[model samples]
Target: MKLSDRQEKIIDLVRVGQPVTSVALADKLGVTRAALRADLAILTMIGTLDARPKVGYVYSDKPKRNLLLDYISDIKVSEIMSKPAVISESTMVYDAIVYLFLNDVGTVFVENNGNLVGAASRKDFLKISIGGTDIHKVPVGIIMTRMPNIICGRADDSAYEIASKIIEHEIDSIPIVETLKVDGDKEQYKIIGKVSKTNITKLFVKMGKSK
Candidate 1:
């Protein structure tokens, strides 16, 4: 949820001070108590502040920690995923190399008919290139590791789950995908985005700095 300037200031004030009374807060903020009612109510309802009949508003440690954990675990892949590097399944290995370098991504999703068919990584391209073959003529589909064999994540999957998949598979990234049914019950997935180890690290750093 987007927070207004006053709401953000309220949070900062509560964080740095002890429980504060509405009168004192309003005086300090140069606003009337009535003006703060909605802000305080929203903060309390959202578990950001604890209010008592006479004790005023306080930031509860336990609730704040729980909120942080919930935020991390409930974060969807779509929230943190980056635009996926993609190539047509029919793209030549030579062209794929050029695209990969231009995009500066370790892996690229290979698509056919709008469906994710496979993936090619820098390692995959290097392996073929080292063989002294005519990569310029070889379709990436022939060298890519196909679906069902590729590890992937869903767009709605939690970021925590995506991070786990990356570690468990020992891969640099996982494609965020959506499942589609085709051909009388056969299912295929379309690539939407990518979650990488770097993304997880950035999350960790952000959480740490906030704490």
Candidate 2:
């Protein structure tokens, strides 16, 4: 969410001053108390300010590291995820290889009827390529690692949680998915985006530069 000029000033004031009364802020801004109400409420809701019954408002006490974590924690996977490299499950291993290289991504999501069913990585392609088998005749579905074995992130998952999943799985990328109910009892994930270590690194770099 974007902050208004008055709200930005309010944040600056709270950061440098002791708990400041709304009346004082209103006077300093040459506006009425009512004018600052919405700004204060928004700042408070976004964790930029804290208010008490009689103490007025103050900046949050969160340290720099914790503040960065808070920022990351509030970012959803959808905000950072990039276009996924996708292929049909029936795509031949040779075609999948070409697609992977063209996309320049580490993994490709395999889909059937628009729902994620499997994924193929460089390793999966390599395994088949080196077997001396006919890559052109082998469908990726035969060698792709199917869902239930795949580690994925939800579109609403926090950036911090998705980053943790990447580290824990020791994989280059993970598909961002949305859940769907099928057949009245089974659930499936539909791939929507992809997140990678590179994306996380870029986020950290951008945040650091902002500091």
Candidate 3:
């Protein structure tokens, strides 16, 4: 969910060690405590605000700015990335279907031996299911598009780079594949997170404020 100007102010206020009580938030936002509570609920649901007893909401620890933002704004992949939706290559199509529906996300990354191997979109699963294929019998690997050609991202990559890739490739999300070095050997790729269009949109909102 996109945050509003008031919501951003609330987050900033909370970050600066200000009281985030609904009454305080309401006063700052020029809204009723009831309205501020509603706003806080949304932020809490999206993992932005911490729920407390009477102390009210608190912002999650703010991320530190880097050299990238010296040229750009306060936008980073951490601020924009979505909770990863990863599955093993051996995952059943039925499982993928359930995850997609439950998470309301359209794509899932496929892992093999703890490394990224492929990705499957909702369209891939839908096409197979619609073609009368038994989901329980279909491994996601059968329909997944493999890596090497797949687009990916690094965790520390700037939001601008992520956004550019999303626009350039016309993809819904980008997997954040971390490199694993075993026994001091060469780095191998493994997906650890994911960033999506929705995430980029949030970054845009945050950057708009910093400007």
Candidate 4:
């Protein structure tokens, strides 16, 4: 990785000073410690610098491009996924809509016999609600996007995988599911959680707040 002029300067400073603190570096650069944080984090992440408790920063002499695992890619779906709002496929569309609002989620997963069967979005509920059809009478299953059509991910999946699928599928949420073997050894999906736009945003916000 090509070092920025500031990064090169940081290296020079650390090499000469040995164990310099962020406060001292900020003073020398005529910038606040906050301004130096990103640079220092990058430098530390790429093994260009080492941070010690109380002792401060030191030159590590590591290759700048030793970038192996990026932080975002290292985050798994299980870490960021939220509890899914699930409803029985037999549930009335109006009841399903109520559950969606109660959970404050964009999409609701539908399950039958403990196995995920389908999914319905807020738009689906809204469309059915406004149509001539009586939402109170219609089963959510009738309007649901059936399983195998609804995109899903596993707990072990990377957050990046979920994000890419969300963009490509143009869906607001993706259910996190697991395989269930039923009678005759038939495979089924068991809905456990969901990853939504809000979940992603919360993860990023939490990451930003972290050291």
Candidate 5:
């Protein structure tokens, strides 16, 4: 879409000197932190923004910028992991393929009794398809990588750590996970949002145009 005048202004400022804190920029813009946050969220959703700790918001003008390394270092997996799309062990290969394609997502989380069990990716679907297995007869459990040493991140940690791990491990995604606390609080982890190539690409485009 269309960006408003203020949004365009924000882009210009970020392009010149990113790694700037929201507080600093917000003050200059004469807007409340809350209002600025709302605007940032809007820009981010449309792939025009990114944020990190110690370096505030970043407008990536470099197309090849290592956002995962340069900016996401302060972010946690919980902050950027997209909502989990769960499938049972019994889910059919045919149906799984449909789900992945329909959602335009690269992978889906396999769950059993609300606990993460495994992961299935587009590559898995392709493999299955090539195996000549009966898509309808086979269950996802038959082919999915079982207990694939899931990579996870906690909400309390910095996103930078999460991004670093992703790059180091050569993995594209991480599941945000949490355990219970001593105070009888139900420890829950819901993938809040996702940070991927898509997120980085949006930031690059927005910053490039701004410059």
Candidate 6:
């Protein structure tokens, strides 16, 4: 959400001149009109400036909300989440890695009896691969980071919160889960979908294209 110095300057010029044309702003800033296009578009997208037909750029007195953040915070996980790649916990690491490649995913969720139990990443597979362990005999269940320890998200969770968890946990993806049954202190969850780094990046890219 940090604006560059040039972007700050562009805001200042538009504010002082009020309804300044892109051509005038570019001239004052000693840049071409094309160079100002991106900045102007970003300002307008962020609610910092308003563009009027037949007019020019004028500062928007409305609340300056970071539109990207606004979109993320308001967006639900189910809106952007992709179908998660899943494998049985008993699947061999070698087979799991192959499945991971076939599905084009960085992480794979491991389930037992249709309940989410664990997750494993490419890094984990690679680590085991080079360790001289017989991957064919090494089940994903043993290598996978088990549930209650793995971070998870709900269908109703905000995309922003899930994205933050991805950063905070230093993981590639989060499994979106639904509570199934409670066994005393233990709870079972069914994997529904997942939100990954690629999803968040695409969301940002789409939001950035806003007018």
Which stretches of candidate 1 lie above 4 Å from their native place? 1-71
User: 113-156, model 4: which lDDT tens digit per residue?
Assistant: 89999999998888888889988899999999997899999999
Backbone steric clashes in candidate 2, count? 0
Checking candidate 1 for backbone clashes, the offending pairs are none
Best by TM-score: 4
TM-score of each: 0.65, 0.67, 0.61, 0.69, 0.54, 0.69
**The 10-residue segment with the lowest total lDDT in model 4:** 62-71
Prediction 4 TM-score vs. true: 0.69
| Superposed Cα RMSD, model 5 | 12.4
What is the alpha-carbon lDDT for the whole of candidate 5?
A: 0.68
lDDT tens per residue, model 1, 92-210: 99999999999999998999888998999888999999999899999999999988898989888898889888988888889988889999899989888999887888878876785
**Candidates 2 and 6, the one with greater lDDT:** 6
Model 3, 1-211: lDDT tens digits are 4679887888888877644677777787778888777778767766677767788777765323333356454456766677778888888999988988888887988887788889888778878988988899889998898978789998788888887898999888899978899769956787878888888777667656853
Quote the positional error of residue 191 for candidate 1 in Å: 1.1
Candidate 4: deviation at residue 71, Å?
1.0
lDDT values of the candidates?
Answer: 0.88, 0.88, 0.79, 0.90, 0.68, 0.91
Ranking by lDDT: 6, 4, 2, 1, 3, 5
Backbone Cα, N, C clashes tallied per candidate? 0, 0, 0, 0, 16, 0
Q: Candidate 5 on 1-211: residue-level lDDT in tens?
A: 5778888888888878786788877888998888888778776655566777677888754432354345545544444446656788789989988887777877777776565667777888898898888899998888887664766666666655665676888666566665534448645344434455454445446546753
